[model samples]
Target: MTVLILGGTSEAVALDQLLADQAPEIRAVVSLAGHTSDPKPLNLPVRVGGFGGIEGLRHYLIENRVVAVVDATHPFAAIMPFHAEAACKAENVPLIAIRRESWKPRPGDRWRSVPDISAAVETLGKPPRRVFLTVGRLELPAFADAPQHHYLVRVIEPIGDRLPLNGVKVIQQRGPFEADEEEDLMRREGIEILVSKNSGGPATVGKLTAARRLGLPVIMVERPPKPDVATVDHIDQVLPWLVAQGIFVTERGV
Candidate 1:
């Protein structure tokens, strides 16, 4: 049974690496959304971009003979898994989600939870404060209502257009950033408030830690609800499932 991995997160990459090394005989392909300007290389053969929609995905699955699916998209990705679930159900193929757990507020963290990006902006209030905007480029526009605040946006690439905030500085960096680095950035930029989506993972939690140390209040956007489906938090758990499908043969080499 060929496995299709809906990839774009670290968990997806881990699963791909495991499959490449342990289940080489299993024909597996990773699918990337290609939203990032530059994404890291993965071990498995990857197909980039969307599959048109539910029908397009159904057609691709039927055409490629995909027997099973593993959905390991970013936590904030609310649409792709929905499409995967619909397509897999229609095709009668088993599907499982591999989601990384989100971050919980620690003892020192001063977190104010918001339902969405717009709510987070509202929580920031009328005062013009220097903000560390860690929610990503797509969510940046939500701050248009509060443009008086200075923003230090950390992104994989520049927005390449007019920013919603009048006072802004963009930092181009990739994870995993260290705690010391995060502290330095906050201090250098004189950030007073931290805004972030609780994208649960180790690769990008340094800002939260730094905020805690500096006693800065964080506007944490809660993660959206995920679709109901079989899910796993670890990579190795999928091996048994693959074996159950009679697909994890011991063929060597990638």
Candidate 2:
């Protein structure tokens, strides 16, 4: 059986690796959105770029004989999941979503949750003097109208083009950053407000802690609902499930 993974996030990478290691008999392919400058290498075969749309994805699945699809894209990757769901349904292919759990406010955490970026912006009230934007490059456009605030935007890749906001400062960096570093950055930048997606992972959790420590209000955009599919939160759960479904004979280390 062949499996196609709609991928980009670290969870996708881990899932691909786990599948390869545990189910070598099953052909696995990772599909990247090609939005990042330097995406991590995958252990299995990969396909980059959008699958056009639902129709295109269905065509690819039919042509490639992909029996199953594992959507491990970013939680806020709204359109891709919709496309995947439609394509899989049309093609009659089994589908699953590996969604990372959203982060909740802890005992000391001060978070202002909003359903979307627009709502978050509204909740911010007036323009903050100094804002740390941890939202990805794609969502930066939403903040263009809020140009009165000085933005310290951090991204994994260097933004080649100028942002719509005049006072935007870009920082190109990957995560798993230390809490101390985040705190120091907040201090140095004189950040009074933080805007971030509630992307729950160790890589970027430091920012949340930093915001809490400095008593800065964070406009946390809530994650979207996972696509309708058999879902799992961890890689270990997937292998056994696949085996039970007769997708693989036994665990074959990749």
Candidate 3:
């Protein structure tokens, strides 16, 4: 059996590791979108770049003889799910989506949830005097319309490319940031507002806590919905489900 994982996020890495350890007999391949600087290395076969479109993906699946596809991509990765659904259907290949649940506002957390980035930008109301943008490099263009505000943008990789806005200050840094450091940065930069995607995980949750501590409002953009497919939130659940579906033999019985 051959399995292909549409990967990019940390969860994707975990899923890949789980699959390899539990089902070494099944060949696994992970496809990355090539948007990150230091993507986690996988022990399995890896492919980088888009599959062009639905037809292109169908061709790849057919050629590779991929029996199952696991869409373990970022929740915010909207288009890939649509393509995966279409391609898998056309090729008669089984598909599953592994998505992490979105984060919810806790007690004392000030959050304004928006459906999308454009809505988030509009919800900012008047231009904030100082803003912290943690939305990543791919979606930075959405803030171009809010050029009136001074933005302190943080990204994992250095952006050698020019941004559409001129009033932006770039901070090239990796994540897993500390809450204390996040608070200090916001204070020193005089940030009154925060703009971020509701990417639920602990590595980047420090900024949200920092914003809440300083009473700063966060314009949180909700993740895009996944396409029609069997989906699971945890690796253990997915492994059992896959075995039940005959994608792999149950380890205990086998």
Candidate 4:
């Protein structure tokens, strides 16, 4: 039997390794959205680019004889989850969403949670303050409203001349970032405020730790709605789901 993993996040990468090691019999094929120019390759066989949409995904599941799907995309990549559920249902394939735990406000974490990007823009307010914008390459147009603030944007790809904010610096990098490094970057930049989506993973969660330590006010954009599906927080949970579906003979020591 085969399993499809919709991957772009670190959890997805980790899950790929776990499945390869634990469930050797099940052929696991990972699908990437191909939004980024270069995505870190996984050890397991991977296919880049989209599945065309819901119809394409459904067809892929049926054609591939997929036994299960694990939606391990970003928390804010909302639309994909709905499509995963639909495709799985149509193909009679079991689906599990590998959703990471959301970042909660820890002690000294001054968070101003906003409904969406527009609200986050409003919460950022006016009059120039150095800002650390960790929201990535999504809707940067919203930040153009608060252009007065000196913005330091972190993205996986180069934003180039297309960034909407006037005074801005872009860091083309990915993470597994050290908390000390994050704190130092925030300190050296003279950042007074932090703007980020609640991506909720250890890779980018260092920013939250830095914000709390620095006592900076964080304008956190809340996550979009995810489809109501069987969701698991950790990659290990996927092993059990595969076993439950009779895809795997038994769970190996993980």
User: Which candidate number would show the highest TM-score if scored against the true structure?
Assistant: 1
lDDT measured at residue 18 in model 4 versus the true structure, 0 to 100 = 87
Against the reference, the lDDT scores of all candidates come to: 0.87, 0.84, 0.85, 0.86
Tens-place lDDT per residue, model 1, 108-145, is: 88999998998999999998999998888877777877
Order the candidates by TM-score, highest first — what do you get? 1, 4, 2, 3
Candidate number with the higher lDDT (2 or 3): 3
Candidate 1 structure lDDT: 0.87
Clashing pairs in 4: none
lDDT by residue (tens digit), candidate 3, 103-218: 88988788988999899778877745688989888777777777788889999877665356776899988778889999999999999999999988778899988998999988
Candidate 2 stretches with Cα past 4 Å from truth are 251-254
TM-score of each: 0.95, 0.93, 0.92, 0.94
Model 3 residue 161 CA deviation (Å) reads: 3.8
In candidate 3, what residue range of length 10 has the lowest lDDT sum? 158-167
Candidate 4 CA-lDDT value = 0.86
Q: Which candidate do you rate higher for lDDT, 2 or 4?
A: 4
Q: Residue 239 of model 1: what lDDT? A: 85
Q: Residue 252: error of model 2 in Å?
A: 11
**Candidate 3 — what's its lDDT?**
0.85
